[model samples]
Target: MMQQLFTNAKVFTGTGEDDFVSAFRIRDGVFDWVGDAADIDGQDAVDLGGRTVLPGLIDSHTHPALMAGTAAAAECFPPAVTSVDELVDVMRAHAATVTAEDAWILGRGFDDTKFPERRMPTAADLDRVSTDRPVLVWRCDAHSAVCNSKALEVAGITAATPDPVGARFERHSDGSPNGVLTEIAAVGDVAAFIPAPSRDEQIDALIALGDELASRGIVAVCDLLSSRLADPLTTFRAAAERGLRLRVALYPGWDPEQPLADLDDDDREGRIRIAGVKVVLDGAYSNRTAWVHEPYPDSCDHGLRLVADEDVRAAADWARRNGVQLAVHAMGDQALDRVVELFADEEPWLTGIPSVRIEHATIVSDEYVRRLRDARMSFGIATHTVFFFAEYDGYEKALRAEQVPDAYPIARLYAGVEALALSSDRPATAWSGADDVMLSVEAAVRRRTYNGIDFGPAAAITAAQALMLYTGRARMLSPLENVGEITAGFDASFAVLERDVFTVPAEEISEVRVAETWIRGERVFAR
Candidate 1:
């Protein structure tokens, strides 16, 4: 490796607003000096042409394995497929290339809320794509899916088939299946029958996904649901050996009946490692399945609670015994309250980071924030702004008039909690560029949806503060050291930007692009 000095550039170390440096020195993949350009005048330095530089970003919560699996699927996301007719056309085009009569034709990222018809695509709509083969399209949330009639038959779902414990199959007037499967249980029934790709194909997909992430300036990520891939720990390790770009922390989904296999000694420390276990306590607010205290508008039904208290306790116990973090998916207030109550008396992790993380603390009240801080247990939250930015129509129907101001209160949480991160649950989100760090940052700064609806302007934070949610503030989400900063002894990883994000107009923050991305002091991507 070469020792290099980068000079004549604006660098934000991510510590605070005043933490800027004109130059930095990287020696053997770590920062050795980050100070004035005058101090290193004698040494040969690479001039940066006054470009703005930021620490390489960290996406605290994402689903890389799931994204990789669907890389080949037809993208039915908004702006491209805004109606049921458009969705069918995209799937049909994808189906045309597949010659196999028995192969499943797959599509993803269809949001009914954005459709002009305001309705989910039914089996009949998908039947136009193919009747001889299976056809399935996932709603953007990924919690539910709609399949063609042939797929329903393949999954053994019929008029007489009983709904699973926590899932449902939408039916028509005569009790025949409508081809809409709601929640994980119902989605899994059809998903299980879809043939698994070859191990080599899985590895290839992961590597390709890593490259895509690198190009977006993300150097690290926490795959919240690693179990989406078969034996994720081993598979990710193989991808790393084959030169995957990002450093990943895996959190395999926790199951009561089948616990994850014990981690190998080599799996404890490396480019890829198991960070913890994840257990989803409730569904998402977008689909009105978030288990909220109040029922949705004009409906008596509150959303579903997917797991039992005992099951959550079992997962907590597993994390405690193994000395790892336990990330709970609690999107609604009621579900968030349950987590606080259950762990109120527990002690903090000896490592001093959060022992328990509440994923998507979406509708947090001041009382909940106070309780989380005052509790004996150390708590962290991973939330998002993109949910509102991209899925505003869904929220419009789900939240009450009074509850609107409190949803994903970014500014409040930033002040109230020490361990808070704003992350994009990509591929699961409704937008095409859901993983774009700049897009999420812009949403946090502007506090406006894609259609220019302001949730609450007072809840917005500054551009720099929003960036911290993906940088220094986000470091606590993973155990990887020397990350999320440009300080001395930290990893020599950062992204050079075309323009300064801090000085740009509030709405133009998302327009800033990475000119170059470097990992471990080696330039991996350049535009």
Candidate 2:
């Protein structure tokens, strides 16, 4: 007999096509049965008083440990800047305060695209701020970084150094490395010289971030990378051992074609799990780096591929044979085209066969949509522009101008494919909550926002369909069992919705709230 019997709860089982808006029974950490209220055992009832019950939501992407690091730096946030002069003034004030010999003049929240003229902060621009100290002013995208001449000299980068394959080093016409370093590889090159937080410091940050996410009703997260840190394996493990209550799925790092023989298996007793290898096929399109079928209309850039496909195939085949899951990061249509071709024609893999999730199917086109349906590949999307672009514009403009309709294509997904997986690529601006999620859903379904602004509203999906994406869709994307859904033998994880997400007004959906969350049939979060 189960210890908890939630009665009178409206269980949203399955998704749009197979949804059952009915009651369910939970016993011994698994769903015993589901039916009308009359079918439930009254003897051990814990009535929910007609609240909505949904499968515990899953975030298919995030960098959990890096978030922990950000949480650690919250108090040190460099304040906002009003004008160019004001920005310099603020940095000068902060730099003067640090007495340490090698102290960093760190500041976030400068968007090159936002200024009256979309110009990057030059080394000269930062030198005015603090000539005496090393200044590293990062762009909001985190892709582009502007460092003062002092910091640039310390990095040992100059005109002769060729750009890292997948990254861009903004250069002087004289071919010298400009202060701006774009993308992960270049950022890594410069950051590689910076000292990382020690084990104890990282552990402390992880615990703090875990508390933050838990407070936001996030029970599980899938991290992309740990940020400025190459050793991601130790990051998650430290969280588990040091009082992290949230479940973590780490999906990062890949040496293309490298065998996962040294891979770690899931540690269920602990909350953290190594989801699998992450492969970056192409850079994102905004940087004009997403691998594509045709060259950009106005740019000579045909996009860039990080690793050759045959090489990736060898790795995928090896992982499939060995029981490792390969999470490929593909953002451009052309890159996706190549990946689909490879997946369709590749030989059956061997072992670590987990779900082949396509990270950031950002430009999910019609041809790609059909291919996605045909291959039944697991996919995850982060429609975070709603929050990410609160201050900055041009995201939608760039997409529309380029004739890309699927900036957020949930409807096309449900219509053309079977599964819908969602993620909040955190540290993108904000973290989780019903408000943050509902806004994305509205963008997915209503195709519009508060002011009735429309980007690609035609691509919007239904609420029922969207709910499934956040719930059981993760399992569909992976070979994992009983993880996404609540079934007879599945892990018992659920969230109680205070209001029906399907019926709520688009903008008001966030107004509805999370009442409680259960992980393994035990109450872990109560709102």
lDDT of 2 by residue, 253-368 (tens): 66653334455454322456565567778875544566776666655677678777666776676556545566777777777777777775444342323346677676776777
* Candidate 1 local lDDT, 57-175, one digit each (tens): 89999998887666667888876789999999899899988776567899999999999999888999999998989999999988899999999999999999999767889899999
* The best candidate in terms of TM-score: 1
lDDT against the true structure, per candidate, is: 0.87, 0.61
* Candidate 1 vs. true structure, TM-score: 0.98
Compared with the true structure, the alpha-carbon lDDT of candidate 1 equals 0.87
Q: How does model 2 fare in lDDT? A: 0.61
Superposed model 1: Cα runs more than 4 Å off: none
Candidate 1 local Cα displacement, residue 214, angstroms: 1.3
Q: Where's the lowest-lDDT run of ten residues in candidate 2?
A: 70-79
Model 1 worst lDDT window (10 residues) = 260-269
Each prediction's TM-score against the native?
Answer: 0.98, 0.83
